[model samples]
Target: MINRHLRVVLAEDSVVLRDGMVELLATRGCEVVATAGTAPALLAAVVEHRPNVAVVDIRMPPTHTDEGIRAAVEIRARTPEVGILVFSQHVETVWASRLLAGGAAGIGYLLKERVARTSEFMDALHRVAGGGTALDPEVVTQLMRGGRRGRVDTLTPREREVLELMAQGHSNRSIAALLVVSERAVEKHVAAVFTKFDLRASDADNRRVKAVLTYLAESGG
Candidate 1:
């Protein structure tokens, strides 16, 4: 059994799935504080109830792409105390990485099919709610094969683009030219990327080289 009865807010676009999850959680000794079918509704429900944890589907209404994942990210910013378990039928590595960029504490990313059994799903949920990791084995293996455990995963999309350009031996000015941005703007992104990677050096040029090497290593080259 889990540590205690947890208050949960659930978001799943499919009415059938949402209702089924509500019932399943209730039976597992959880309090289903709120249920939502869309990303906005999920945010609102979370704000109102302040549940201990939220189970959010990666896809949701209107677009059905990554609305749920985006909302979950925002929820984390607003309420870091609320644990998040992001699930999807498909493996979206970028989204998964983004969800875990900050840290894995109180976070989960499990494939929907992996939860075919109620017991396993409940266990994963409880684990996340109590500040433990519950990543899918496939997800872990796939991410690992990229030669990136989580450090590279921590880079934002734009930052990754900038880093890639840097790794190609592009100077700040050259990177700006390639990306069609000002050199000053590129400098900010470069600094942010290096800070995220925690690279240190005696000089700026050396630091950039180290960052580029880290990127190459992460790319498995």
Candidate 2:
């Protein structure tokens, strides 16, 4: 469940879309502390409010190219504690890779049209705000296609499936349910993936995030 007091800073160039999002979040018990229509304003709002999460659009004013993503990278560097969710109309793998280079915790990249339900969108927001990943399945698929076939090639078909699901930000139990397998089976597959990726147990780093990072890096994204 999402925290009713979840605070958010929204960034989008479209007034209609931005206002719609603000209303949507408000109805779901989230507070939109600030909203911005440009990358500079978005950065300022985040720095000032330090909201739990910031929902950003990929394209904004001026170049209408990568300003949003660039600002997102800056936000990650400046305030690692604030979560960022990229709500874009298109999937730019290179941009996604750059945004996630530092880490996957408290990061999300979701395609706007692909998000079919309100619950799904809210769940993603909650996950990112709580220091979790929320990658879209399509993003995962494209990254896998471009990924270098090194350690990833050695995995069994089932393990690859598990890894793909993991990249999509699914939990072990969720993967098990989707694959129609037992949670124990999913755990085994997850363990194998970590070992294959040379991700050792660590108190300072999340192995799951590490695995996903490896997958993204291998993708050259």
Candidate 3:
């Protein structure tokens, strides 16, 4: 008997995982409002039902490359209020960064193995539902690998702060408020950092979060 009653949409290329996830969420008191096994189906479900949260698999059918991440990006651009939780069998930091390319709030990247820990897994769901970020520890470790190469430490303290906050998925305005600065000032800092890294002009089309991650990757952060 579901008790919590959350509106959920699930997307997994694997039929077994999709069905298993639906049952798991259902048993946890969540209402599985919809399910899809492909990226297109996932996007359609998100648009059609406007589910409160989308639990997506990192690899989907067809290419099994980054379909889920692309779908999540679309969800972010189209439905800012719908939370997303990306589950992956491996730690794919590039796609993980993309999943959070919008901002870190209301998003998560968890290892598929972690789903075995029912309590922890469910907590991740609740956190995303509450507009928070839950990055898998392994994912963070993977992202930090570049730190040892001295690529990421090029950032100044302020720049580092901006990058860290950006990694957490905070908007520029929100980061500005947290740092007690004007939004324009924040923009200037972001631009300067991007310029120093030679990424701003090259990645002009990248989303704000994407720019930050690119900078971090270049820094080896």
Candidate 4:
């Protein structure tokens, strides 16, 4: 379904990985419109090229810290149509949460190891480009564990399950399918879960999913 010949911008400090990613995307019919070795360069390229998607490293030059993620946020603010996929060597769950604080849609956070799997990497890019979230399973697991413990215990077992699935970037329809419940039932469960977590009125801009993802990422689950 990802037939669009996407124009992509890549931002990675490492030359080897950046080249590899460009080649990979080329082979998959994507156009590598631009590439940058630092956060500032990445932002400049994205702004100039106005690429359809940007594959950014969570850690980029200057500080070798969270520059890439910061650039992604700036991209989201300036160009809403430009999808962002952040790659990281470590979990950096807080960075992920911040990148998705507005909403996971049109955004992705994946561990660097995932790049070795061509199909999976492309799928993540495609999903992001199509306005869907793509979260690494490992990252989700870690976040869910934190939520499992502590005060989040007020959530029922089923609500916990729902929250976990939501953190995994599953849609209400998809969650319903996985839980073997009707969409209406899933909606009720999600509402209850949100209420239990004091997330009422937190659905501004349909950002409840973003709120959940943010909680999980910040919890380091």
- Per-candidate count of clashing residue pairs (backbone under 3 Å): 0, 1, 5, 2
lDDT of 2: 0.83
Candidate 3, residues 1-221, lDDT tens digits: the string is: 12355899999877886788889888888888899989999999999999878998878889888888888888988898999988878676666666666667788888887666888778888888777767775565575443333434676888778877876677789999999999998888787666554554654335465445454445432
Report the lDDT tens digits of candidate 4 across residue range 84-138.
9887886765556566555566888889875567788888888888887777867
Judge candidate 3 at residue 117 and give its lDDT. 82
Name the TM-score of candidate 3. Answer: 0.73
By lDDT, the best candidate is 2
Q: Per-residue lDDT tens digits of candidate 1, residues 30-58?
A: 99999999999999999999998999898
TM-score of each: 0.66, 0.70, 0.73, 0.70
> Best candidate, TM-score-wise?
3
Stretches of candidate 1 exceeding 4 Å from the true structure: 148-221
Looking at model 3, residue 119 earns an lDDT score of 82
lDDT of candidate 3 at residue 3, scale 0 to 100: 34
Instruction: Score candidate 1 by lDDT.
Output: 0.77
Error of 4 at 53 (Å): 0.6
- lDDT ranking, best first: 2, 1, 4, 3
Clashing pairs in 2: 147-219
Off by over 4 Å in 3: 1-4, 148-180, 187-221
Q: In candidate 4, which residue ranges exceed 4 Å CA deviation?
A: 143-145, 149-192, 198-211, 214-221
